[model samples]
Target chain A: MRNIIIPAVLFILVITFVALNLFYITDNASRLDAILVSASDAAKNGDFEEATAEVERFKEEFSAVGKYLFAVIQHNEVDDVIFSSNRLLALCNADTKEQFLSEIEVTRESIKLIRDAEIPYLENIL
Target chain B: MAVAVIRTVILYIIIVFAVRVTGKRQIGQLSPTELVITLMLSELAVLPMEDMQKPLLAGVIPIFVLVIVEFFVSAVVLKSIRLRRILNGRPMPIIENGRINQQNMKKIKLSLDELAEELRILGSYDIETVSEAVMETNGQMSIVLKEDYEPLCKDNMKAKKEERKVPAVVISDGEIQKEGLLKAGIDKEQLKSILQKNGCSSAKEVFYMTSKAKNSYFIVKKEKKQ
Candidate 1:
């Protein structure tokens, strides 16, 4: 009885943990992408101040969620997003509209890749 | 440095726990699935230990997932004979009725030389002596000798032998073992008399003592320091 129970409990725990991770990465990725899009639109409209604020907010949120992400996602994938985020922030601070907009797109894609990797899609599984 | 030390300790504990969960099969006795699990466990544990940037949970989660899967598979296999056969192939009989089953041996890829080697290892120099020889799923050979080749015992000679109780150590390094005395079926007074008979004043004077029965005992006195 104990033999069955321990493994069953652990199996449930692993499943729950994986499901929670999928929810977390998906929710957080969309949130981060929304922020990047807002920042990109602001920079395109010549609103450097709002764009800078949005970029700053993006960095703060990413850093907060990154601690959790590091445990679930591969360190390299999470680090790639972190690196791109920093680059986007640097471009935002410099008020480089053209570069900042493009960097925002790149950062958003990286975040999407992380979330996609977590999803149990046929393409991703293969 | 401290991070490495802490991670090593944590991973070590997790690995030990994982192995314990898999049960007490030795390396040589592990089935194919068990061997794969054991290999994967060590590989998974070493990844985080080598690269600090790799999250510890990355290593831990997979280890646990594998353990849980293996556990469930074992449970399912227990109740399903077909699944058991699929996972662990049926034991192949290499020899039957003092004759080598060449077709079965060939099917399992057991060469004649290998069979001879295994038989030699099992104390049978000649294959003809083995009435039955099976290659178990764990890869060990089980051999049964023919009636004429079987070793002679007391039963074969029709001799009667006395049943003797296992010797229980009642004293070790001058200390009394209460459980051992109970097993030997002797009380403190009987132990004292046994010690007196053996010319020992007390248990402290004896180095080792064992009792096979209530009155039967073996005692060795401690040597005086030079």
Candidate 2:
């Protein structure tokens, strides 16, 4: 039993490390997903300029998500609008600091919708 | 702060137990139902953590209600087929016999482009290659491949595997799984049924009906062939 404990401990340590890494990566991925999703929403609502900038910000923040999320999100028919808006929250930032101090205010509202909509869709992925 | 800590601890326990009751689905996999459940659970799980003023009872009561609701719905589904149909909805046939069901698609508001896109995500490139497609209750699409696209048999569209040999169980250590006996795909129920099709009839006669990942259900009967 004592002999078993060492490898078990090491094994657990390894698993915990991997699990933590996965959690970190997942957090990053979800954030990026939110950003790209918001951008897609903007694009859909005929805010191409906002969408473009959101995507650029997302790409800067989470490269992997920025790279792949657009194609995937576009392919999926978002059944719930709030979920789409939540994804937008992940990507939301001021278009310009001067022109949009109100971006944060808009984002606060979007965050509410995003949480309401996005939280439902997110259960399986996490 | 002490209550906050206590609440967090309690929240974790409740969430974990609820998830366990709900099934391995929280951590394991995502069918449509599981996905929806996960979504609802997560949002709700946050409430207990956030509500500092409300007693833990407030958080716990709703969870109890959810489980009760789940149990009630499940019982209703188990007892009544019509109620099941009304609550869960039937599998919508998105495609049937190699043709898209345009009427069904319109009812679900699914477009042809959307269908193709969903299929592509599932690795089926061409709609013509689909035998059938079903939109399952939890909002996931399942598709049956056309004969040509299926990775089995002498037709040989793909050289993946010819077929698999599944083993029939005669005795599991000493007893038998009766359902395992029939699933060996053998017919003994009626004289009118077809002859010599993958045959088996006894449980005390089988060792175990299992196949390798790519083998047929090979039955090891109690008595050896002469």
Instruction: Identify the leading candidate in terms of lDDT.
Output: 1
Which lDDT tens digits does candidate 1 get at residues A3-91?
A: 89999898678667777778888999999999989989899999999998998899899999999988766788889888988888788
lDDT of 2 by residue, A63-98 (tens): 444333333232232223234434444444433432
Per-residue lDDT value at B137 in model 2: 70
Model 1 regions lying over 4 Å from their true place: A1-126, B161-178, B187-210, B217-226
> Each model's DockQ?
0.03, 0.01
Top TM-score model: 1
* Quality of candidate 2 docking, DockQ: 0.01
Which pairs clash inside model 1? none
Best by DockQ: 1
The alpha-carbon lDDT assigned to residue B160 of candidate 1 equals 96
